[model samples]
Target: MQTVIFDLDGTLADTSGDLIAAANACFQALGHGEVLDPLADALTAFHGGRAMLTLGFERLGVDTSDVVDREFPNLLVHYEQGIDRHTVLYPGAIDAVERLRANGYAVGICTNKPEGLAELLLMRLGIRDLFGSLIGADTLPTRKPDVAPYAASVERAGGVVGKSLIIGDTVTDLNTARAAGVPCILVGFGPEGSGVARLNPDALLDHYDGLDQIVARLIGHPVLV
Candidate 1:
């Protein structure tokens, strides 16, 4: 079976706002008062909590990473409380997934987010049951860009690595597909806008309405319509 693996943040959904808010909460605890703007720093937020902490710390002229480690857990705590506060699935994301599943494509998520957080966010978004499988950052010994998690996600979703591809919004996702020797379809509608094309993915999806045809074209499935 053919499989379509998705990256959670900035791919199927815009999770940056809540992510940045969590990091800002950590900064606020230290009297920094929301050092990370949910709007301006959205791209950085998708890089993960550590990146946000490092960016905020740099703003405070603090060169040490010890504090970043210290505040990491706190950031997670804050994030869990409001995971879906400002998060929303991209337009046509669910519709695309449904159409693909209806057409016999295996669909799953391989996110760099922790397993628990990914599950929680999906459930909060009321889309958990839609995915056939989920491979998170800690699902295996290693994560994305490492082929292991990607392959695992495909297999668990009842597909083979040879007939799989990834839809994502980051370099990490591109690297993951490259390592897996699969085509990468990046979302041009993500936080980086059309700038993601610089990575030169196999295809750039500007909207989900055309995804059925794009996936079929790239993965060798018969065009759905």
Candidate 2:
């Protein structure tokens, strides 16, 4: 079967708010007081905890590497505790995934997030059972932009790599799909907005409502309107 692999953060959901909150928590612990802004630093949040910490340290005129390494664990702890507080699935995301499944496509997640954290977030959102497989940063020896994890995610979801496609929000996901020799569909609603088109994916998804058609077209599957 064909697969539609999704990148968790910034793709299926807007996780930047909670991510920034977690990073800010670390700064607060050190008397820095919320160095990261939820609105201004959203893109950095999607880049991951380390990136957020580094940005915070830079803004505070401190050594970023040492602080990032030292407080990374604390950031994760705070993140896991309130992962879904401000996180929410993009509009029509769940419905689109369900439609894809009903149309005979295997849907799964291949994220750079830690496996346990991804599972926890999905479970909290009440959508863990929706995916056939979920491959996280540590699930395999390597992560995205490396074809290994991407292929693993597809196979684990009972899909053929040749017929699979990836739907994501960043260049990382685009590169991963390219490395795996599969089509990629980048979400236009992400932090980068329609500017993601510059990356030249197989397609740009403007909204989840059009995902089924986009997936079918890219993967060579037919869907009856």
Candidate 3:
């Protein structure tokens, strides 16, 4: 089966708002009081909890991974409490996935987000059942930019590794596809906008509306089982 694996954060959904809020919770608790601006720092938010915390610490001139590590759990806790408060699926995302599935493409998710939180967010958004697999940061010993999780996601979704392509909005996603020797489709509608084009992925997605065509063009259409 052909597989279409998606990145969770800025690809399928705009999770930056809630992600920024979670990181701000950690900084607020430490008396810093909302160090990250949800709109401006959305790209950083997609980078993950640690990145947000690291940026906050950097802003305060507290340079140490140790502090970010300690506050990570706190960020996760706050995130869990309000995961979907401001998150929303990208326009046509759900429809595009459904179209892919209907056209015989196996669909799955590969996220740097922890498994539990990814699961929670998907469920909260009422889109959990859409994917055949959910491989998160902790799903394997290592995550994307390493081919392991990507392969795992394709295999778990009952698709061939040779017939897979990744749809994401970050360099991590680009690197993952490169490692797997597969096509990388980067989203151009996210915070980085046209900036992602500099990475020169296999394709740049302006919107989810015509994603299936991009997928077919890059990797060939599914066999239509």
Candidate 4:
């Protein structure tokens, strides 16, 4: 079976809303005025929590260490509280996963996000069972753009490097695939820390619907219906 490994955030789901709200909650706890809209904040920090916190503190002229100490925990707490409240599966993502599974493709997730939180988000999205394996940041001592995580995900999914595909939204994702020597597909709607176009992945997908064709082209097999 063709194995498709996915990145959790930005690729399969839009988690910016929840993340933004969590950051705002942290700011509120710190007694700092709200600096940005929750959704906008999440989008801006699509990279991760540290990136968001750094941006927030930089905007407020606060020390990074201070912000990390006082606000980071609050942010995590808020996120844990409503982790799934506004998070959403990207359009056509569920359909694509289901189609891939139905076509006998083994699906797995390899993400830098914490394992516990990633699992929670997937379960909340009602797509947890769709994946055969999930390798999160905490799953190993290191994460992407390290190749070990991808290699581990493939191993867990019962796939080989030549038979697996990595799908993500950032250059980091493509770099991870390169390090793993595996094929990769890029999502146009995801983070794109620099620019999605600059990454030059194996394929560019405008929507999750485009994933099916991209997979067909890469694996030379009908992995999507």
Candidate 5:
């Protein structure tokens, strides 16, 4: 079956509010003062947790690596508490996944989020069963920017590397897909801010609605959303 793999954070959902809350909680608990600006969340469409932490510390005129070792778990705990506080599906994401599956494409998720949390979010969003398989950071010893997860997801979808497409909002996703020798699609509206053009995916998508057209081109039959 044709396969489509998606990244969780920026590609499928807008998780910045929860992420920012967690960052603030970490700073507040440490008496580091509130550091992250709301815009930092927008910028995070590219980088994940570490990037956001680095940016927060930079804004606070502090060195992040020094505290990251201690603060990482705290931040994760804080973030998890509010995981669903404001997370939302990017526009057309649901339609895209549904239509792709209806068209006989095996859809899966390959994300760096921890497996349990990713599954929680998808289930909370009521899209858990839409995917044929889900791969998360903890699913294996290796994570994205490494090909293992992508290869595994493709295999779970009953396909090989050459027959799959990886969709995500960051360069990490593109890098992983490239590592696995698969075509990549970047979601323009996700975290990367404005430099997504440089990632050089096979296509840059602004909305999930546009995805059906892309799938149509791939399968030679229009996908119904």
Candidate 6:
């Protein structure tokens, strides 16, 4: 089956607000009182908890490595508790996925988030059933930009690696697709906004509504609708 693998954080949803809040909770416990800004630090949040913590520590002139290692677990606890507080699915994301599935495609997620957290977020969002498989940061020995997890995700989704494409929002995803010899579509509406275009993916997705057309064109399948 042909497959469309999506990146969870910025590709399918805007998880930055909640991610930043969790990182802020870590700083708040240390009396730092919210060192990262939601709007300004959103990109860092999508990068991962460690990146956010490192950025906050840098802003406070502290040794980032030690604090990050110590507070990383706390950040994950906070994030798991309130993961959906400010997270929202990108508009039409579900509809787009449904369209693809109805048109004979298998859909799945491959994220840099830990597997447990990714499952929790998808379950809480009530969209866990949409994906045939989910490969996360720790789901395998390595993560994105490496071909292992990507290939695993595709195979688990019942897709041939040679017939798959990735939908993502970062250079990590782009590099992963390139390494796997597959096409990638980067979202223009992610935390990096239209600047994601600079990565020059096989296609740019400004909205989920255009996904069918883009996927069809790149994968050489006819759009069902």
Candidate 5 residue pairs that clash: 45-191, 45-192, 46-191
Tally clashes: model 6. 0
Candidate 2 residue-wise lDDT, 1-225, digit = tens: 879999999999999999999999999999889898999889989999999999999999998757789999999999998899999899999999999988888999999999999999999999999999999999989999999999999999999899999999999999999999999999999889999999999999999999988888888663435
Q: Worst ten-residue run, lDDT, model 6?
A: 216-225
Clashing pairs in 1: none
lDDT of 4 by residue, 1-225 (tens): 678999998889888888877887777777887766765565575788878888888898887976576666677778889999988888899899998888778889999888989998888888899898999988999899998889888778877767889999887889998998878888887654436878688888888877877897788674444
lDDT of 3 by residue, 1-225 (tens): 889999999999999999999999988888888899989999899888898999999999997659989999999999999999999899999999999999999999999999999999999899999999999999899988899999999999999889999999989999999999999999999989989999999999998887988999988887653
Candidate 1 structure quality by residue, lDDT tens digits, 2-98: 8999999999999999999899888888887889888899999989999999998998899855998989999999999999999999999999999
The sequence of per-residue lDDT tens digits that candidate 6 reaches over residues 1-225 is: 788999999999999999999999998998888899999999999999999999999999998757789999999999999999999999999999999988988899999999999999999999999999999999999999999999999999988888899999999999999999999999999999999988889999998999999888877663344
Q: What TM-score would each prediction reach against the true structure?
A: 0.97, 0.97, 0.97, 0.92, 0.91, 0.97
Clashes of 3: 0
Off by over 4 Å in 4: 191-194, 222-225
Q: Please report how far candidate 5 places residue 139 from its true position, in Å.
A: 1.3
lDDT of 3 at 204: 93
lDDT score of residue 113 within candidate 2: 99
Q: Pairs clashing in candidate 6?
A: none
